[model samples]
Target: MRSRSRTYSLTFSIYSLILFNSLALHASEYLISYRYVVKDSALYNESLSISQAMKKCSGSPQIALELQTDGNKNLKKIISQNSEKFTEYIHKLGMHVEYKDTTNKAMNKSTTIMTLQTTCFTVDFNDNFAKIAPLK
Candidate 1:
């Protein structure tokens, strides 16, 4: 009876390991939108000393990252890598990203607006590095 019990425990442990491994292998998808502003040189005026600027996408995707778990180093690295990948994907898809530039002579300021839309593939730092695909 003791031997049989030991066998059962071992089997359960093996299955648990398999389950954990499977979960680790799974990936999550997310849709990300990022926006930023930049100075539009073309619209800038030297006489007025205007600083031209443009806005990119509105913001980033909603992904909560805890400081305690998602350290700055890992977060920065991942974000930089994702940006490169997203740019490449956009170019490959022939996506046109338009930035609107404007200048206000009276205000002595110029603005350029830009938007970034893409699906980011990510890996969970806490989930055994499971792959996360971009959201549709």
Candidate 2:
């Protein structure tokens, strides 16, 4: 009976560790700031912004003005395909990205920023919050 109890406790301890690590890996708080910058395109110099880039996105959320990438995939899929490119493009447009919740915005924030704990790509376009993991 003692040995069986010990085995049960060990199993419980392992399960707890896995649960904690899973929670720690994914962060549900993030902030996106809008900004504008000047860049020279093929013909003229113009000021561009993240809102503009979003317009160009071909998904539910746009990335440019009336321009779409011609894809049925969501923003998360696009990022997972090539996060480096997407990250670079957005970064160049004077956008700020944060992964922690330290401000009032985070408290009222609804976007979920998935970290290494979850899937490879996680993005929320609307004001959607993270779903609570079901207890087993």
Candidate 3:
């Protein structure tokens, strides 16, 4: 009886390990959107198109995309790593994304916004989104 119990425990442990590995492997599908403003730019006087800015993503599928606090700045590539979550948010907003960043020299993305939803969302990068897997 003891030997049987040990075997059962070992099997359960193996399945748990597999589940954990799967979750980690796909974590990037989700990301927290980071928003901010850049008070240091030449375009201090002009109205920028939000859609046009995102459409200019530099060849990446795009992930976490948001207008900088001001129109002249943009946040790209940062969210591409977690495009899934980003896309989901935009979709939930009743919109589609992947805009252009036609401005010369882009804004630096250092911070990210917190996760928008407690459940799942798209990241808009690789056209995928998933829920934040619970940490072990």
Candidate 4:
């Protein structure tokens, strides 16, 4: 009985660790102000005031104006395909590179972590804020 109890406790502890790590990872999926820079593009460091940012991103005249945003994607794919553009854009702007939420579907492991800089841009960082405003 003693041996069986110890084994059970060990199994429980392992499961608990897995659950905790999973929760931690999922909680990291959202961001408040995510920067998506295009280094090689001519718009680097153009300083689109929020108004200009919104205006340049506008799609249809009916929509008034909109800002461009990119949805979450696999880390490997993003790095492979957009590595050049992303790196160049940030360098040109004298800013950091664009990053993605660690828990994004594209991000597989829980160990990968990233932070959201709330003051950098305007966006709610509440838990469900991403759902409130669709990623462009």
Choose 1 or 3, whichever is better by TM-score.
1
Candidate 3 — which residues are off by over 4 angstroms? 31-136
Local distance difference test, each candidate? 0.43, 0.35, 0.37, 0.35
Best by TM-score: 1
lDDT of 1 by residue, 23-46 (tens): 554323233445545564553321
TM-score-wise, the better of 2 and 4 is: 2
Per-model TM-score on C-alpha atoms: 0.36, 0.26, 0.26, 0.25
Tens-place lDDT digits, model 2, residues 1-136: 9999999999999999988776544432222332232222122222222111221122132232111223523433433455456445445434432233334744532232322211112233333322111111
Compared with the true structure, what per-residue lDDT tens digits does model 3 show for residues 73-131?
A: 12244335545664565555443222223334575423222222222222222323222
lDDT score for candidate 4 against the true structure: 0.35
The regions of model 2 sitting more than 4 angstroms off are 28-136
Give the distance in Å from residue 133's predicted Cα in candidate 3 to where it truly belongs.
20
| Model 2 TM-score relative to the real fold | 0.26
